[model samples]
Target: MKNGKSPGSDNIPVEIVKVGRHRVIELLRIAFNKCLEEQTIPEIWNCAIVILLHKKEGTGEKAGSDHVRKTNEWLRHQSKVTDVIKRVARLKWEWVGHMARKTDTWSKRLLEWRPWGEKRPRGRPQMRWDDDIRQIAGTRWLQVAQSRDEWRSLKEAYTQVVETG
Candidate 1:
């Protein structure tokens, strides 16, 4: 319903509906009734506008396709694909933490393993999977993820972060 938002497959912007909700509802009712009688959804519903984005690094700007922006502009404003990616990432981290807590020899070894005495190259150290996990889930994530309900709630928190930030 925000201004300057692009229309979906329906080609109807939320602003139009916002200004004339009753009339829009009536028109939608007719269209939906016809669709129901024909037992077919509109092909427009499947349409998505693809936009290409150029790569721009070190500018602190998001450089990618417009899918994320378009998804955030929907009528219902559902979560974008990035949110799913974040949720999956958090779940994988939780799974790893859960496995690390296991009493098995392999799990214990993995939890305690470290690289030999080798000097790292200059500049920023190479990013590790554990670093990304800690960045998203915090240092106490392992303890929080131990409980099923707590992990689920943590995932929800991550979901909100993904959606808003």
Candidate 2:
């Protein structure tokens, strides 16, 4: 793993990590098992990056939002993008519970606590992380997460519901 090009949170290159697969497996098993025993994964793992491509029309011109939406609709009607998105969203939902429980940072606190006095412009309200979770998992997600087993079991099905609907 260490010799490879990719780097993870520990900053150890993959080339270094690949030196001893057994050692890596043992270390990961121990770390992951500890998290499982504690019923909470660490906050560091609960993140993802979203990149949007500039979609083009049939004529090769850049499409506006409306045209992009139509293209996406057609693509979705023809293939499995919807299912793939649901899977990604399910994984994301699995992290929200763990993230909600963390309080060691100001940014995390702001996201989870959602303190008052912030006003939005007169147009669309900014989408908060909590709002996305709620739309997928429902208003009682925090309560649901209290039972780790139930939360894990429902994550897949719930995200599918949110995605398809």
Candidate 3:
């Protein structure tokens, strides 16, 4: 085949027509390795890492969230990096500390920010953290917060729970 897809399709995502698969896998392997090597779990995973590789972007790749979910699920069962997983978990604690620092700064800024506004928005801004999210804010997490204070509080409370448990 001249390309991975049949020649008949008129519209093709450019990434599919251009980049090679082995290269893409190699990059993920690199990220995985770097994450392990640094003893850090990246705060961000580049959208381009997998988003650009979507079949919608490339004919050869899968586009649905299920595809990504299945991939991660497979990775979970694989025994290739059990030790690395533990190290990553330990790194998560450090990330919690970083999050606390960021949130404390945010809380301070928001306190100052209030002076700039005549009145805060009524009802809710949709970013407020409640009790349950705070409960899992640490070692075992469920959801994430957009603002730093909510994240810090959640992590702190969650950390207590993990320590007690």
Candidate 4:
């Protein structure tokens, strides 16, 4: 539910959902539960809007005799799409660093704090938000994040590690 993303087929913006807040969350939860019980999602969920940009010159006019051929050619000529997973990982890593450096924000506190008396009901420990940060920057990642230059240097390696593993 990140902001500024394009609306889906429903054309409902994220801002509208944010305005609804808890009421929206509760409604969504109920709807999702009902969908799970019925084993069917809304038909609107299957719809998508795919807009093909006219990347080359002398294109984008109304369809004509050569439209299909030109569209196929343009599609074939396009390079591979950028890796979304790597981009998201890099962004998350950067955000973690930013939150880590903030002195007294609740975000920073929650990022570092573990519950005092929480009991685990699992064999293996669950993965955490900062697990990748710890993997790249070691146990002192928070301290390292305090230095912007040092944190920035780790971004490439972090993305690579995330991409591969």
Candidate 1: where are CA atoms >4 Å away?
1-69, 72-83, 159-165
Angstrom error of the Cα, residue 13, model 2: value is: 38
When summed lDDT is taken over every stretch of 10 residues in candidate 4, the lowest stretch is 73-82
Across 70-165, the per-residue lDDT of candidate 1 in tens digits comes to 433462233111234454556665677677567657875776578899888999888776665566668765665567776666665654554565
Clash count per candidate: 0, 15, 0, 0
Task: Name the better of 2 and 3 by TM-score.
Answer: 2
Candidate 3's C-alpha runs over 4 A off are 1-31, 35-71, 79-118, 128-133, 136-165
For lDDT, candidate 2 versus 4, the one ahead is 4
TM-score of every prediction relative to native:
0.42, 0.41, 0.26, 0.53
- Candidate 3 shows a clash count of 0
Quote model 4's TM-score: 0.53
Which tens-of-lDDT digit does each residue in 1-165 have in candidate 2? 124466755677776666776677667766765664465778877774445766445543355333434566574454322345565677677677676555577744664575579876798888765676676557887776767887788787777666775
Score each candidate by Cα lDDT. Answer: 0.62, 0.64, 0.48, 0.77
List candidate 2 segments past 4 Å from native: 1-83, 103-108
Rank order by lDDT, top first? 4, 2, 1, 3
What does the lDDT read for residue 30 in candidate 3?
73
Q: Which window of ten consecutive residues has the lowest lDDT sum in model 2?
A: 59-68
lDDT tens per residue, model 4, 46-161: 78787776555445466543343444335323422234567678888889888999988898889878888989886999897678779999999999999999999999999999
